[model samples]
Target: MNTPPSPPGAERTDGSSVRIGVLAPLTRPGWAEAGRHLLAGLELAVGEVNGAGGIGGRPLQLLVRDTAADPRKAAAAVDELAGLGVAALAGEYHSVVARAAATRADALGLPFLCSSAVLDALTEQPTRWVARLSPPQSRGWQLYADFLLGAGHRRIAVAAQPSVYWASGARILRDHLAPRGGTVIDLDMGALTPTAVCDELVDRRATALLLLVGHPEPAVSIVQSVRRDQRLTESLIGAPAGQPEFAEWATSLGDDGAAIPFLRYLPERLSPLGARVGAALRERLPEAPSFVAFEGYDTITVLADVLRSHGPDRALTADSWPHVAVEGTRGRIQFSRTPGISVWQWAEAPVQVVDRDPAAPDRFRILHAG
Candidate 1:
């Protein structure tokens, strides 16, 4: 159960292996598949690195732990991995888990890099032990705002899960709309009843909706409610999670709603690295892939690069490296310089507006591409 020790350049002078821990949601209710997808990406990265003669010829090993989207589990997992003496820690899509792990990592003085968690609060701590490789939620909001403003939607309603990311984005949207003579109506689903959500949307008379739910049921319910009562026919809908399932929901509600999904990378086509990642994922899980996959891939890639460049002996603290710029499956990645530094420079891929075709429920047509 002994973990790998750090060397001068993350190299093993004594033939010791470098253990990097990946903490993710493996058994969470709606996120099991996403967790699998993320693991698939990590597998590709490790396999590729090991196949290419390992990190500094010492072979890199991944220690996988299931956080189950639980903060306590996340903290406990870090304790276990830390006891094993892992050189570094990598985070997942669960921001709460990232926050918890960051706290522990900071206390232990271990370098922590976040791959997918985008909540701004994770980086608000005063320590330089954590670095986020994913862009902040604010950037995503700016993208959504730009998209909405360009589409001529002046009156907008934001429907979110009342999570950290959504709540922050709602405020940013409201602020951004203030100068343009536009209106931003905020809806926190966690506080209001589903029926109340429907009533509020109808009352706002908003011309567009920004949905922030991460699952299928709530998303579908919101759409149905909006369609049944709210005058959203002429309004545009934007979400970061508007996948095929949401389109199906729109069709089920008999609403030909326009949808825009703000994703991590632009261009729907896969990159060379993405191709390798996809193949690895198909072999491992063979189900639907989500944005978490890319997050995991980028996390490992960046960690490997840093470990290789810095070697095992150099301290891998957060302040040890101010920024990381890597070419991922999407594009260039640079961590944000915000005071708390919650976001990363992971290039958000182009957003596309898609609609569910009445003739083909499972199919979607791209009306716009960013």
Candidate 2:
């Protein structure tokens, strides 16, 4: 006989706890390490909120579902979580997965505070039901572009898989660099082997290589090949999607993963609150936490504040995006309608271009900040 399935997230029948549904990539192909850190931040914030009296003493609880980086899985999770009576929804690390969850949450009229996905067009149409803490892709990638140009790179090549996020990053670089006498060559990772990528780099004379692909497979292979290539010795490798932010990259590639500048949302100095949370997150996670963990903490903090000031009613919580004024681990958190973005975005989340020290893989060095 098959084991019975566990009922999702609707654990409290008496309505004593205010539930917030969490969507994350906790399994394979979903960047599980990032998911772990994101969950850590969310869990930490919930504990603190409960300790301080949660949502007017009712307590806040998280019902987490693993999206595993699948858009369809995330959409289905939104439906299930909304039906299970969550007051709000939060947490997703992958851009495409978050987009799916945001669309579904908007359709169901469930309030969603997106934690980490930065896709600019989160929803096809603007809706008050979703707010985001991360900076949009366009802004972050353009800043990454600025960093490349500042470092005297003009001829660039991107090794990319078939992904909207990858395509968008390539497009952003091409658009930003074209007018400034810079050129971008796109290499299809689906067709090109890692050696082929190095060969293409040599033939094309591209000075820089960007990895706009997934982690640990193609990305790792490509980096190893490029690092070992004698011809591409002087070329630079980059990952603007923040692939090197996690410890796994360092563990997987060692010094090969270091010095590959990527975009990260962080200030030069952590706030007093950020400092405190950083210590707490360090204790919670086995490895040092990424900015994603901070994003997760800030997500619950904002949602808890919304519930306290407005109420747990979904409509009011959705409408409360404009009134959120919490001090997040990153910086002051607030949202507004950006011109092209379809959701309320935290307009002032910090952005930086950083890379690990080749000498000390555990230490990050800020190359550029904006």
lDDT of each: 0.65, 0.91
Candidate 2 Cα outliers beyond 4 Å, as residue runs: 1-10
Candidate 2: give the clashing pairs: none
- Candidate 1 lDDT over residue span 18-40, tens digit each: 78877777774425556666777
What is candidate 2's lDDT per residue for 45-126, written digit by digit as tens?
9889989988888888888888989999999989988888999999999999999999999999999999999988899999
RMSD to true structure for each model, in Å: 5.5, 2.3
Worst 10 residues of 2 by lDDT: 1-10
Give the deviation of candidate 2 from the true structure as CA RMSD.
Answer: 2.3
Which predicted model would earn the best TM-score? 2
